[model samples]
Target: MRAIATPGGLPISDPAALVDVEVEAPQALPHDLVVRVEAVSVNPVDSKVRLSANPSDTPRILGYDAAGTVTAVGQEVSGFAVGDEVYYAGAIDRPGSNADYQAVDHRIAAHKPTTLSFADAAALPLTALTAMEALEDLFHVGANSEGTLLVLGGAGGVGSIMIQLAKRLTSLRVIATASRPETAAWAREMGADEVANHHDLGAEVLRIVPEGVDYVLSTHSEGQIGAFAEIVKPLGHIAAIDDGNLNLSPLKPKRISWHWEFMFSRSLFQTPDIAVQGRMLADLATMVDAGEIRTTATQYIEDFTAAGIREAHRRIESHGTQGKIVVTR
Candidate 1:
């Protein structure tokens, strides 16, 4: 198997930051499926792990979003079989999808949408899981739910799906924050009812909904906690998926609730409902086939080379790319 890995967790700018090498294929565990990866997408987590994670004796493979075909299945795997086309966000604790072959827990993997290409399908898993969990599991929004949702960072990878899901699955009046004109347009394309500048978040939101928003999904969670606290309605829910110091004192007065959404939690902890990730991805696949949810892969790397992967990491670290960046064979 061919793989791209970081030996010492070096910076992306380093020439040897990611290297291509030949390695033995992973064996399937009791609940695992060995997948032959066709396409993979870059996420912020990849860059974070590459730069700051503890170095490993062996090179560490760093990728989460992947679309591939199952070449072998574990003894306990039930829903998938050999030659099944599947997609998943690989578990954080395991060797990831940045290789020709990867062993993924079948509980978190689902059949890919028949309507999309491998690159497009690869872009949806991590972001779709995160957005679905943030909106439904954390915020308790559903089909009948009617309220306003302010999606922070509404033009990025997760935000792209968040905006679409909110509109298609729920009755929430969607408001999204995007600073750039192009991003704002993209957010609207994704089904946001209104788009506001993140620079003046409070004012921009207030202008759309006279009262505060009922829910806030902070995808880009840096320095926006205070603004979220100030702009949310009393007893509203706030969910975020970023790493940084946060102050919750501001939320106390309004009796607001805050949740941390890490899409990898279920698979990482081997939770009882770990299969929910697979279920959700399957449902999302249905939606995609029905033309309800669209892929967020705005940029594509034509070849799966070390240089291409490095450039993808560089763009993700720069924090300016819209939607998702996928690399395919």
Candidate 2:
């Protein structure tokens, strides 16, 4: 199998940061599906791992989002077959989807939406899963939920899908934060009821919702902890996906319920409800087919070579990309 991998932690500008290699195709485990990968998307985690990973004799494959066809199925796999087309954010512990073939747990993979091409479907898994888990599991939002929800980093991959999911699945009035004019328009296109400039987050959001929002989903929660505390309503829930040295004392006075949402948690821990990812993805497919949601793939590269992969990573590292960037074979 042909794959792109990082030799070790190196700068993206370095040619050795990502290289092409030939390796044996992976085989399916008892509950796994061996997929023939067709397309993949690059996320922030890819760059983080590439930079932070220690140097090793063996190169590490580093893709999480993939859309592919199942070429073989493990003995215990039930919902998927050899010919099924699937999409998933493969477990972080295993070799990732930046290869010709990938072995993924069937419990976390779902049939790709029939309405989308492989490139488009590839863009959804990781971001969609993050948004879905943050809203449904962490925040406990549903159809009857009526409140103003604020989304930070609203034009990024996860936030793009988050806005659409909130609008389609729940009655929550969504206020998304985007600093630039283009990003604000993109957020509105994704179904955000209002767009606030993240540069002045507290003031911008408070201007729109004077009483403060009922929930906050912080996609890029680096230095905005204090702003989140000031803008969110008392007793409201706050969910964050990013990791940093957070000073959480500000939210303590308001009794705010803080939640950390990591989409890989269930698969990483082999949780009892790990299969929920597959089920939720299936439901998302139904929604996609029904036109309730749209793919967030804003940038597409037809080349799937190492250079192409490197360019995708560079774009993600640029920190200015809107929505997802996909690379197809």
Candidate 3:
């Protein structure tokens, strides 16, 4: 199998930061599926891990979002068999999806949407998992909703998918924040009832949704959250994926409920509830197949060559991408 890995913490440049290497083919575990990876998507976590989670003496693989075909299934695995198409955002704690073959826990994987291509399917897992975690696990706000919500970075990977989910799954009115004209338009196209600028986040949101929002999902900088406090409903909930030195003292007056969404939590700890990721992903797949949701793979750069992957990373770092950026083999 072919792979790209880093020996030390993720290197930013040169020195084969993400060098090509050949590794032994992975075997299906008792409850695992050996997938022949066809396409993978890059997320902020990919770069973050590249910069932070490198192995000391050996190269660490970096990827989490993948779509592929099951080549083999463990004896203990049920419900899926050889040649079953699947897509999953794997555990961050495990070796990633950036390879020719990967062994994934069947409990945390799902059948891919019959309508989407491998690259498009790959783009859904990570971002969808994050959004689902934020809404279903952390804040538990998507179901049976009766309040207005604002997705602070709704044009990004997680936010892009999140906007649609809120529209289709909940009764909540969604207002998404996007700084640029293009991004704002993109958000509206994705089902956002309204759009505001993240550049002037506080002012823009207030102008459109003056009464304050019931839920605020900040996908951008934590440093900008103080002003966000001004627009949150008095008893609203707030969730953020980007962590910085956030000074949340201002939120005291509002009595806001804060939450953090990391899709990897269940997988990282090997918790008894790890199967939730698999089940939730399956839910998303059903929605996709039913045409209730759309793929967020806005860009695709072919061939998993090291340079191509680097360029994909570079684009993500630029913060100008509309949705997910995929690298395919």
- TM-score for each predicted model, relative to the true structure: 0.98, 0.99, 0.95
Q: Which residue runs does candidate 2 get wrong by more than 4 Å? A: none
Query: lDDT of each prediction vs. the true structure?
Result: 0.91, 0.92, 0.85
Better of 1 and 2 by TM-score: 2
Residues 1-329, candidate 1: write the lDDT tens digits.
88988876688889788988788999999999999999999999998888886777688888999999999999999978899999999999999898999999998999999999999999999999999998779888799999999998889998999999999889999999999999999999999999999898878888888789999888766777788778999999988888788887888989989899999999889889999999999999999999999999999997787888898999998988999999999
Q: Where does model 3 exceed 4 Å of error?
A: 9-11
Q: Which ten residues in a row have the lowest lDDT in candidate 1?
A: 219-228
lDDT by residue (tens digit), candidate 2, 1-329: 89999987899999999999998999889999999999999999999989999998799998999999999999999988888899999999999999999999999999999999999999999888888898889888899989998988889998999999999888999999898899999999999999999889989988999999989888878888899889888899999988898889999988999899898999999999999999989999999999999999999998887899999999999999999999999
lDDT rank order: 2, 1, 3
Candidate 3 lDDT, 1-61, residue by residue in tens:
8888866565566656677888888888898899999999999888888877646667888
Query: Considering TM-score, where higher is better, how would the candidates rank from best to worst?
Result: 2, 1, 3
Please identify which of the two predictions, 1 or 3, would achieve the higher lDDT against the true structure: 1
